[model samples]
Target chain A: MIKLLPRYILSFILLVFLQVFILNNIQFSGYINPYIYVLFILVLPFETPKWFLLFIAFVLGLTVDLFSNTPGMHSSATVFMAFLRPYVLKVISPRDGYESETLPQLKHYGSAWFIRYSAILIFAHHLFLFYIEVFRLSEFFATLARVILSSLFTIILVLISQYFYRRDIKR
Target chain B: MRSLLNFLVRIHFLLLFILIEVFSISLLVNRNSFHKARFVNFTRQVAGNVFVKSNNLKQYLSLTEENQRLAEENNRLLNIIESTYKSDEIFFRSVNDTIFNQRYQYTSAKIINNSINKKHNFITLNKGSEQGLRPEMAVVSEGSIVGVIKGVSNNYSTVISLLNLDLKISSKIKKNGYFGPLMWEGQGYQSAILNEIPLNADIQVGDTIITSGFSSIYPEGILIGFISDFTEKGGSFYEIKVNLSTDFKSLDNVNVIGNLLQTEKLNIEKQAEQND
Candidate 1:
C-alpha cells in the first residue's frame, strides 16, 4: 500500500469523512452504531509491509477517536484488528491464493470471500471496542449483544458501500 | 551478534505494535482521571472545528424547532415572573434578597457535536474557555439539567452527557425531601438510574427528579427527569429509573452554568474538614 499512498490517502480521507460526518449521525437504534471506517483496513493490498499496516491502522483509528471524542478507544481496537489482519488473511486465503492483479475488493475476490474476511475483522474490532469502552464485566452479556448487533450492521454497511466505489483501473 | 541482530529485526514490527497499543491503552486508562494528556485536548479542538463546519450546514434545518423551544422557555419564565411580582412591596425591605445575589451565571452555547448511542456519550458545544466556560460547570437545556462540562478549549467545550455511564449527578425526589445521586446505567438515553432515596420517600410514578443543589454544579431544584419505574432493589435504597425530560436527540442550545460561590464554599469546607 506504500507504493499507492495517493490512492489510499484519498480513500482514507473519504472514509473518515463518511464515518464522522454521515454515518455517525445515523442512529438506527442505541444498540447498533455502525463503524464502516474499518473497511479501510480490510481492503489493504496483500503485500503491505507489517510495520506500515500497523502505522496506518493506528493513525486511522486515532482519527476516528479524535472525531468521536473517544480518545483511545478506536485506536486500540483498530491496531488490534490490524495486528490480527495478516493472520486472518492467511487463514482465509483462497486455495489458488490471492491474484497478484487484484486488490482485496468485493469485485476482485468475490462477495463470499470478501464477506468472510471483512466480517472477522469487523467483529473483532467491534467486540474489542465495546468491551474496552465499558471496562467492566458486570454488563458482559449486554455489551456482547451490542457487539454482535453492531458487527452485523457494520458488515452490511461495508458490503453495501462496495457497490458505490467506482472501479478506477488507473489507480 | 549477527543472529541476535536478525532476531531483533524479525520481531521489530511486533515491537512497534506493542508500543502503539500500549500508548493507545494508556490514553484510554488515563482518561478515567481528571487530568488528560495535552494531545487529546489538541485533537478535540481540531474535531470541534470540523463539527462546527458540519453543523453550520445543518443549522437551518433545525431552526424552527429550536425557536419553538426557546419561545416555550420564555413563556415559562414569564409566568414565573408574573406569579412572584408584588407591585405593592415595601421599598425599604430589600434586606432578605441581598444574600441571594447572582449565585449562578449562565452562558448560552450551541451544540455542535453530540452522540448518545455510545456507552460513554459526549456533547460538544461551540462556546468554550474563550466564552468563560470551564470544566465541571453544569450544562442545562431550557429548564432541565443536561450534563456537566468535562473539557474546554479556546473555542469549544465537551460535556459528559447525562447519558454517559461514568457521570453521576446529585438529584432528589421532588415529592418528598429524599435526595440521591443519579447515574446512567447504559439504558437508553431517555432513562437513568437514581439511587440512595429511601423506600419510605412516598414516591409516585410521575414524581419529578430535580437537582439536589447540595453540590455546587447545578443550582437547586432544576428539573432532571421523572420517576418512570421503581422497585425496592439494591438493599435499603429505591432503585428508581428516571425518564429524562430533555430530548437529547433534538437538543440544540444549552446554558452552561457557573457557580460564583463554589470556590468560597470549597475553601470553607476544606478548612472545616481539616479541623475535624
Candidate 2:
C-alpha cells in the first residue's frame, strides 16, 4: 500500500497536467471535446474503500473544473461516475471476483472485459457531463451527438494509453 | 439510538455521495446569480492569473497579426479626423477638451481568455477595479462592439460576449433608422438574428446596423453588423440575419466604456417609473 501511494500521486499530477494543458486545448471541430481525466477513477484498485473513492473523485473533478472554468459541470459528472463504479464492477466481475491488491488494468482483465467496463462508465460520465453543460433540453439531439462522439474519442484514447501502460507493467 | 447509528453506518457511502452531488449542483445553479458573487469572483481571479501567464507565452506568436490590426485601426482613426476637418470646422473645433464634457471614458485591456462554442460565451479581460472597470460597462474592439462587463474583480473582469444568447443589443439600420433587437441563435459565431423590425421598414441586404443608444451601457452609433438577409416573420415583423462586424475568435485588445452620467440617468428613470 505504501509503495502504491507514491505511484498514484504521481499519476494524478500527470493526468491533471495532460488534461488542462493538452486535452482541453484540442477541440476536434466544435462539438467533440475528449475528457480523459476520469480514467484516474476508473483504474483504481477494486478493493478500495467506497468513501475514499468518492472523495478522490470529487477532488479530481473540482480541480479540473477550476482550471477549465466550468465550475461544477466536471465535478458533478465525476461524482456520478464514481457512484456508479462499484455497481459496474459488480456486474462485470469474473467467476472468482477481483483480487484485493490488483487494480483494474487491461493486462489483468483482458481486452473484452476492460472495454465493456470502460464503455459503460465513460458513456455514463459523458452523458451526465454534456447534459449538465448545456443545461437545457431544447437541443437534445445535438447534445446527445456530442456526448456520443466525445465518449468514443475518450475511450479510444484511454484504450491506447492502457496498452502502453500494460507493457510498462509487464516489464 | 443504537439501531439508528447502525443504519447510518450502513448507508454512509450513499449519504456521502448525495452530499457531494448536492454541493456540486448548488454550485452549478448559483453560478449566474448574485448569491455566489464572492465564490465566482474568487474563482475568476485564480483562473485569470493562470490564463494571463499562459497568454503571455502564446501572445508572442500572434504579434504580427496584432500589429496589422493596430495599424489598420490607426489609419481608420486618421481618416475620420481628416474627414471631420474637411467637412465642418464647428464639429472639428467641438473636439476641443473644454467644449466636450467627456461623458464616456475608455480603459484599454487585453482579452486573456475567450470562448465562442458555448451558448453563453464570456471573455476575460486583464483589467479590473484597479483600472476603474465595473459591471455593465460597454466593451468594444477596434471598430465594433464586443460585449459588456458582467463581473469584475481586482485584477480581472468577465465580459458577457456579444455572441451570448442571453445578450440582446438594441440596433438600428444606419440608413433608414429602423431599429430592432439583435440576438444570437446559438449557432455559428458569424451570424445573429435581428427581430421586431416591422415589415414596412425599408431595410436592404447591405444596410449597416449601429447601436440605438437606448441602453446606457453603449453609446449611440457604434457599429454592430450589417444586414445579410431578411424574411417576413408571420407577415408582420422582419426576421433579419446579420453578419457580425467583430470577429470574436481572433479578438485580443478591447476598450471598456465608462459612462459618467449613468447613475444620474438611471436615477431619473427610476423616479419617472414611480410617478407612472
Candidate 3:
C-alpha cells in the first residue's frame, strides 16, 4: 500500500505537468484537442476505497482546473465520472463483482470491456465539461462538436497509455 | 447492523461526489465577474513560465523574417525622425504632439500562448501587471487590433481575442462613422460580423473599420479591420462581415496599450453608482 501510493502520486504529477505544459498547447484546429488528464481517475485500482477514490479524483481535477483557469469544469467532470464509475462497472461486470485483488485493465477486463467503460466515462465527462464550460445550449451544435472531438482525442490517448502501462501493475 | 454499516460506507462516495460536483458547478456558473483575477493571475504566471521556454525556441526559427520586418520598421521610423528635425522645425516639432497622443500608444509583447481555433478564443501575453497592464486594456499588433485584457497578474494577463464569441467591441465605418458592435459568429477565425449598423449606411467592400471610441478600452480610430461583405438581415440591420486586421492564426508580437486614465474613469463611475 505504501509503495503503490508514492508511485501513483509521482505518475499523477507527471501526467498533469505533461497535460498543461505539452498537450494543452496542442490544438488541432480547435476540434481535436485531447485532455488526457482524466486518465488518472479512470485507471485507479479497483480495491481503492470509494471515499479515497472520490477525494483523489477531486484533488486531481481541482489541481488541473486551478492551473487551466477553467475554475471548476475539470473537477465537475471528473467527479461526475467518479460517480458513474461504479454503475458503469456493474453494467459491464467482468463475470462477477471484480475480484478484490484485481485492478481494471485491458488485460483483466478485455479490450472490448475497457473500450465500453472508458468510452462511457469519457463521454459523460466530455458532455458535462463542455456544457458547463460554455454554460448554455445557445451554441448547442458547436458545443456538441467540441465534446465529440475532444472525447475522441482523450479516449485515444487514454487507451494508448493503458495499453503500454497495463503490464506494470506491481501492486 | 454490519451490512447496514457497509451499505452506508459504500454510498458515502456517491454522496461525496455529488457534493464536490455541486461546488464545482456553482463555481463554473459564477465564474464571470467572480473576482478570480488573483487566481487567474497566479495560474497565468505558472503557464507563462512554461510558454516562455517554448516561445524562445520558436523565435529562433523565425528570426530571419522577424529581423527583416524589424529593419523595415526601423528604416521608416528613422526617415520620419530625420525629416522632422531638418527642413522645418515648428512644422514637425515633437513626435509626441497632439496627433500622436490622440490615436494610440504601443507596447510590444510576445504572444506566448494563443487560442484561435476555439469557439471562444483567448491569447496570453508575456507582459503583465508588472508592466502596467490592467483589465480592459486594448491590445493590438502592427497592422491590426488583437483583443482587450480580461485579467492581469504580476507578469501575465489573458486577452479576450477578437475571435471570441462573447467579445463585443464598439466599431465604426472609417468613411461615415456609422457605429456598431463587432462580434464573432462562432465561425471563421479570420472574420467577424459587425451588427446593428443601419441599413442605409453605405458599406462598400473593403471599407475600413476602426474603433468607435465609445468604449473606454480602446481609443477611437484604432484600425480594427475592413468590411469584406454586407447583407441586410430581416430587412433591418446590415450584417457586415469584417476581415480582421490582425491575423490571429499567425500572431506573435502584440502591443498592449496602457491607458493612463482607466482607473480614474473607473473610480468616477464606481462613485457615481454608489451615490445613486
lDDT of each: 0.87, 0.87, 0.80
lDDT tens digits by residue: candidate 2, A70-128:
66778999999999999999999999999776789888878899999999999999999
Runs in model 2 lying further than 4 Å from the true structure: A167-171, B34-36, B74-100, B232-236
Q: Report the CAPRI category for model 1.
A: medium
Question: By descending TM-score, how would the candidates be arranged?
Answer: 1, 2, 3
Off by over 4 Å in 1: A1-3, B1-4, B32-35, B70-100
Of 1 and 2, the candidate ranking higher by TM-score: 1
Q: Report clash pairs, candidate 1.
A: none
Summarize candidate 1's per-residue lDDT along B22-118 as a digit string, tens digits.
9999888777552355776787788888898899888878788768877998999898767557543632344344455767888899999988888
Candidate 3's DockQ is 0.53
Candidate 3 residue-wise lDDT, A61-156, digit = tens: 878776565667788888888888877887888665787655677777788988889999999988988887666789899889889988998889
Q: In model 3, which regions exceed 4 Å deviation?
A: A167-171, B1-11, B32-39, B86-105, B263-276
Q: Please, what are the lDDT tens digits per residue for candidate 1 over residues A1-171?
A: 356778788989999999999988887766578899999998888888899899999999989988887878999999999999999999999998997857888988889999999999999999999999989999999999889988999999899878777465644
lDDT of 1 at B99: 56
Estimate the Cα RMSD of every predicted model relative to the unseen true structure. Answer: 2.6, 2.9, 3.5
Superior by lDDT: candidate 1 or candidate 3: 1
TM-score for each prediction?
A: 0.92, 0.89, 0.87
True contacts kept of each: 0.79, 0.55, 0.66
Error of 2 at B218 (Å): 1.6
Higher DockQ: candidate 2 or 3? 2
